[model samples]
Target chain A: MWLAKNKDEREFTGGKTDWEAAARIAEQCSGFEPDDEDEQTADEAVSCYNCRYRRWTVKSFSCLLPT
Target chain B: MEIFVGIDDSRQLDGYKAGETASLLTRAIEDKGWGKSKIPSRHRLYPNPVIGYKKHNTARSFSADIDEQYLNPFITYACTMIKSNVASGCNAGLAVVVPERMVNRDDLISYAYRVKEEQVSKEECMQLAQCPGIYLFELSGDGRGVIGALAAAGLRLTGNDGQFRGKLKLGHEEYYVATVKEIIDKTYVQQVKSMDLVRLEDDETVRMGEKVKVVLLDNLYTLMVFPTDLENPKWQTSTTHMLRMF
Candidate 1:
């Protein structure tokens, strides 16, 4: 599920702390390239949480890259 | 003299991370013999949906020690690197400051904290950059990056915001094992504490996690640790999962 679907404000709706959901989404995501190591927040190696395209918001991050 | 460098908006149209530009710039600073640098630190800023490029809104900064004479050349070198590689048609901003000579301004610190929670104006960045000892330069594109660069320099001056770039690098890729004392003795890590900020005793052994890293707290490079499941290695180095709270 997604929260705000607006191009910029779209969030995963799983909230900011959902590590498993992020990793699962990333495993199959063709665009899920890892972000800079310094900025990665997730425990799993490959996750949208660590992607270079997830623009962070106050409560959750918005996926700025197209699916 | 010690020099502080702040950079932001280096992300390319393709998905290059901002920290990559920062770490490369710092590496060049060291390679050029200007001086060795402390690890680049990432200072996050307000994330507005409509503003800025890249995935996350953050800036990177580092401090290096060099002879005062080489300062100009070093800045030139850095600016050239950003233009040629990092910024490439992007609005990259750069700020260099000498803490000792810069007029101490609580306003600068306030400005940094403000950007973390809300949008800031380029006018504010320009005004703050005018303070003595502060030098601000735009490397490419629309120059909106000046706001973030100034904010990052402010964050660096405070020494309290952000996490160091790269891992602290302990034992090996799998896992590292050492006493809390050994970590501090061998590495620049000042202390091995827990998530709650409790400093572990030197004698306690911690199974340092793979790619273990440190956080800046109380203006010190800190290695925060936590407990493992009913094990002899009573404490464990903080993980990327844990340090993200910074």
Candidate 2:
């Protein structure tokens, strides 16, 4: 699907895709990006704070939220 | 677009009944009514035609709207394929392929509203005093801000109900709406893998020492078997007759 320049409506036709290819296409087709404040707030969220019940916490695991 | 599914048909576990086990499947499909519009046919297994189409952004949510847009023809084709496939003996997982460029409006709006409400509250607005005219920086930001927040959150902001609803149609999924007005109020429950020849009926019972195969379709699990005694006064496991393709 491609939106005409400065237009909200778009056109689309079916095509083949894989996961990686889909991601690349999405990135290219997407027209907007978030502002800095939104990014900072998202970054500040303590996604791992609920993971307090553990004997060990690795750096990689620190980024994971409690299941 | 074309989608291909590889089916291993040579693997057939014989010595079981096919007719006795089909009612459960039919009842399940009837309950979901996913294939109501398609022409019914008999076969072991056939490829679903609805597997490989892209979901464009402007498509409507109502089935009627989709039919007007010519999507229903493909959906009907897919349903018919599934019905035929199940009838014939195709037992395997389905593969669906779709284009990535299409965006779902519901997903995009949902993400956008979430970003506005959660991240950029009114208190965060910064007033520019020295720009010759008054300007609030936050008030003028575009959708890029919302998209960025969604990206950071690992969320796709442009998907509609097409992907979710399409699977339901293909697999004979069941669902109930919890809320009528909300966009996200709908839910799904898969009823059957296909509406072919195998099914479960109300007055059927399976006993131990009888041959049976576990049928797993969507999320429902069932046991299939052929009767041991059709003429004897007392049906015993030892006297049962077995047929192929259960």
Candidate 3:
């Protein structure tokens, strides 16, 4: 579900459309914080796609949280 | 006179958002009696990593029917507000367009679509600013935000782009049902339509879920819904995922 991009960053392997996977992963993640309401894309109130720490990349997104 | 205002702020991850600034501008306009402003909309721009945005690549814009005399003062106020509110070391841009005075709207519209499709530069945006009735300003930093600001104005002019910032609170419950006419009366939504773009009749019923939002469509505030149960043909507000394209 994640690809280690660096020592402190990991990218979501599901790309941009895997809502269920993103939500599942976010549910267990302690660092997850909801982004601005307008920026949130997931219907699930708690999802990585809606996390403030997730930075969108070309293919998917990178978690800014330290690994 | 009617004018469209667009702003792009490249603030830090923890800084105030561009949408919030746009919203503040809208309220300030109304409070100053400068104009009756519409709900602000958020335009999603090209998200390529090369552009180097801190987070989501988006801009906020809104339209207002203001006294033509207040145009210059309004612009000055907007510029000052953005500069003061934006985070340090960030770039902020402002674009104002008077559609009635614009001679080459098609060119601006095409540029907007191009910005969403590929990498657009500040030089290109500055070049387009030469067109009449279009104003662009660099409030801070390297002024790269002008690219998004200008694109935002053009996208808003298209009358068919961007989701409105924030949500509509119709009922206190997590989910509630209302007629299309009732929804229109309670909120800025001018029309209710299906995902396929078919307008729902005023008498039609809809079940609005949590965080109901509206989008710009055909130059009106539109609330889009989808059939909740095909068997019953009941309508329900679109989910966040469904409205992502806007």
Top candidate by TM-score: 3
What is the per-residue lDDT of model 1 for residues B1-246, given as tens digits with 9 covering 90 to 100?
987788887545454455777788778777877778777788878775555345567788877788898888988887787777653657778888887777676877888889878878888888888888788888777777778887887787787778887777767546667888888899898877788878888898888677677777776788888888746788888777777656
The per-residue C-alpha lDDT of model 3 at residue B8 equals 86
Kindly give the stretch of ten consecutive residues in candidate 2 chain B with the minimal lDDT sum. Answer: B52-61
Relative to the true structure, candidate 3 reaches a TM of 0.94
Question: What are the candidates' C-alpha RMSDs?
Answer: 2.7, 25.7, 1.7
- Spell out the clash pairs found in candidate 3: none
Ranked by DockQ, top first: 3, 1, 2
Model 1 residue A27 CA deviation (Å) reads 3.7
Model 3 agreement with the true structure over B1-246: per-residue lDDT tens digits: 999998988746778578889988999999999989988999988775765536877888999999999999999999999988888767889999999998879999999988877788788899999989999999988888898999999999999999987788887776788889999998889999899999999888888888788999999999999998743338999998999878
Model 3 chain B: ten consecutive residues of lowest lDDT: B47-56
Cα deviation of B164 in candidate 3 (Å)?
Answer: 1.7
Sorting all predicted structures by TM-score, with the top scorer first, yields: 3, 1, 2
Where is model 3 more than 4 Å wrong at Cα?
A: A6-8, B230-233
Q: Residue by residue across A1-67, what tens digits does model 1's lDDT show? A: 4787666556777877899999988897888877777778888988878898787776677777764
Model 2 CA deviation exceeding 4 Å by range: A1-67, B1-203, B216-222, B230-246
